[model samples]
Target: MKLPYALAKRFVAGESLDQAVPKVADLNEHGIKVTLDLLGENVKDRKTADDTLQHYIELLEGIHAQNIDSSISIKLTMLGLDIDRDYCRNNLFELLDAAVKFNQFIRIDMEGTDYTQATIDLYKEAFKKYGKHVGIVIQAYLHRTKNDIADLAELGADVRLCKGAYNEPERLALQNMDAIREAYKEYLKVLLDKTVYPRIATHDNKLISWVKEYTQEKGIGKSRFEFQMLYGMRLNTCKALAAEGYNVRVYVPYGTMWFPYFTRRLKERKENIWFVLSTMFQK
Candidate 1:
């Protein structure tokens, strides 16, 4: 059965870029930076991938045109990473070219375990030219991510650290929440120590508190790193953090292809279901 758009609206910005504008503006008005995500993934053909590439070009154009203080995030699968690597790279290059013209930052979003290495390889290639205009995400649950973090640190890459949302086998990812948290702490320390700028992305209250205290003790200034969260999740907390003068950005995805994202999010936790019901008509 198909889910109603209304139910999904609680999480998604809207079904099109035009609809997403006000939401982006509203978040910016509240002093929260926004990162726009076009929201389709795993294209099996060239046409879809090509179309997805154009969408981002236009997104970058719109951001520059409107003078919106927002960045963008793109998933490899959405750009045909599965269909063809060369094709995917070319598509990414086109988007990066546009980002250069518009002076916008593009974040390469990490997907499943299968896409990890390829994603990192592509990001490294892009970083050579785009530099800080391009950023990469690292999931702490993965066994390889610590090593990945070390390598990225060498480049002084800007990195975003998250607990990861994908479900992977025990062979690849940490199955226990405690293990993942411990790994996240270790990853955070490396990121703060080495990366040019680290983005701490999490909704866990304990982790948030720890980061705040740890940074103070270690003498890491607020401008050296920023906190990131998904749009609509922990809004109050995001505001509170921003009010405290820390940079906070929200990942706001808008598109007609929201089913996959919507289902995965609601199924992630029982609390998310009530959370959705509570935000039925919220802006």
Candidate 2:
């Protein structure tokens, strides 16, 4: 069944880049930075991958031309990572090249456990070639995150740490909420100590408070790191952080392929599911 456009719009910006930029501008007007993500993933064909690449390039061009204070995030599978490593790398290089040309940034988003290692390898290769304009995300729920963070830290790579959203087997991912939260804290400490600018992305108030206290104790000013939240999840919290003078970036996802992303988000938060059901039955 197709999801109602109104229901999905709570999370997705719209079906096209043109519809999305005004949203980015609105967030920027509220003193929040933006990270635009095209909502397709796991492309199985080269044509789709190539099209995704061009869309990203055009998105970057629009961002630069409009003078929007925003960056972009992309999934490797959308760029043909599953098709061929070399092909995927070349596609990424094109996007990174465009980002460099525009003096902007691109973040390689991490997917499931299966793609973790390959994604990291691609990110390292891209970062080595593209330099400061490229970055990657790390999921704290993964048992290997500490070591991965250490490796990225040694390279002085840009990192965004999130308490992952995917469901995984017990063998590969932490199943306990407390365990994931603790891992998030430890991973963040390592990131703050070694990485130049780590993005802390979470909605937990305890974690948010802890990050503030921890950074203050370590004498890390607000500028050394940033706080990130999804586009529609916690607008007030994001606004509050921005008001407190911390760099806050809103992760805004948009595209016609939004069902998978929307369903995953609904599973992550029961309240969101309830909101949809409630809205569906509204007068």
Candidate 3:
């Protein structure tokens, strides 16, 4: 008989904070920083959003108590974006307040295009009040990202750049892989030239090489910016970068609603599905 998806748990830490805490500690020991993400999105009710907020409050406490060098990232939908804007904003502030108490930063993870503008708006509001304690993500595949980077750089806000995983329409996103990679490189250059403390989040070896060369040519120190990669996908690459004395942070996601997140990761790279299947058959 085939094993259930539960048996294929190696990809995710688990559905609880307790399951993820040790993983964060281990990564810190390896000299890799972490950004802990509690996975879930498009919450349907205030009760659900409130519950998620409470969990994040507890996560903030746990991180401080463990003395682990990790930050938390959250999606607006998980905080009730679909229900009401004020509700979402208030919930976000609640988490931000908790983050402030712990002297930790909270990154607002970018979602699909529908929530992009609202997320930026909320990020700006929080940033105006508490500057470096918060950050936001921008997707390079979007047509407007170049301008967005310029605007974000103006605020001196921390930005995390990703290749975007949502299935967006061609009009709104780059449809070709080469074009997307070109856009990624271009946007990264713009960020490095314009912003401070930008996070280069990618798993592509070629792109990583380009970042290294471009930053070195510009005399940007490794401490001025950091490279970020997904938790389980590029361990060797992350380790190599850190060993070379560059700062690197892993995007560590955990929580119960992992199916959607895992599916998106699989869709990003078909080989990932093959890897999961192979692991399922192994001891």
TM for every model, in the order presented, reads: 0.97, 0.97, 0.96
lDDT score, candidate 3, position 178: 83
RMSD of every prediction? 1.5, 1.1, 1.8
Alpha-carbon shift of residue 158 in model 2 (angstroms): 0.4
Question: What lDDT would each prediction earn against the true structure?
Answer: 0.91, 0.92, 0.88
In model 3, which residue pairs have backbone atoms overlapping below 3 Å?
none
Per candidate, the number of residue pairs that clash is 0, 0, 0
User: Which lDDT tens digits does candidate 2 get at residues 1-283?
Assistant: 8867778888899988889889999999989999999998899999999999999999998888888888999999999988999999999999998988999899999999889999999999988898899999999999899899989989999999999989898888899989999999998999899888999999999999999999999899999999999977899999899999999999999999999999889999999988777767776
Residue-wise lDDT of candidate 1 within 1-283, one digit each (tens)? Answer: 7777788887899998889899899889888999999998899999999999998999998888888889999999999999999999999988999988888899999999989999999999999988978999999999999799999998889899999888899999998988999999999999999876899999899899999999999999988899999876898998899999999999999999998888878877778898778767576
User: Which has the better TM-score: candidate 1, or candidate 2?
Assistant: 2
Q: Model 1: which ten-residue window has the lowest total lDDT? A: 274-283
lDDT of 1 at 251: 94
Q: Can you list the residue pairs that collide in candidate 1?
A: none
Q: In terms of lDDT, which candidate is strongest? A: 2
Tens digits of lDDT, candidate 3, 129-187:
87889999999899988888889987887999998989999889998888888999887
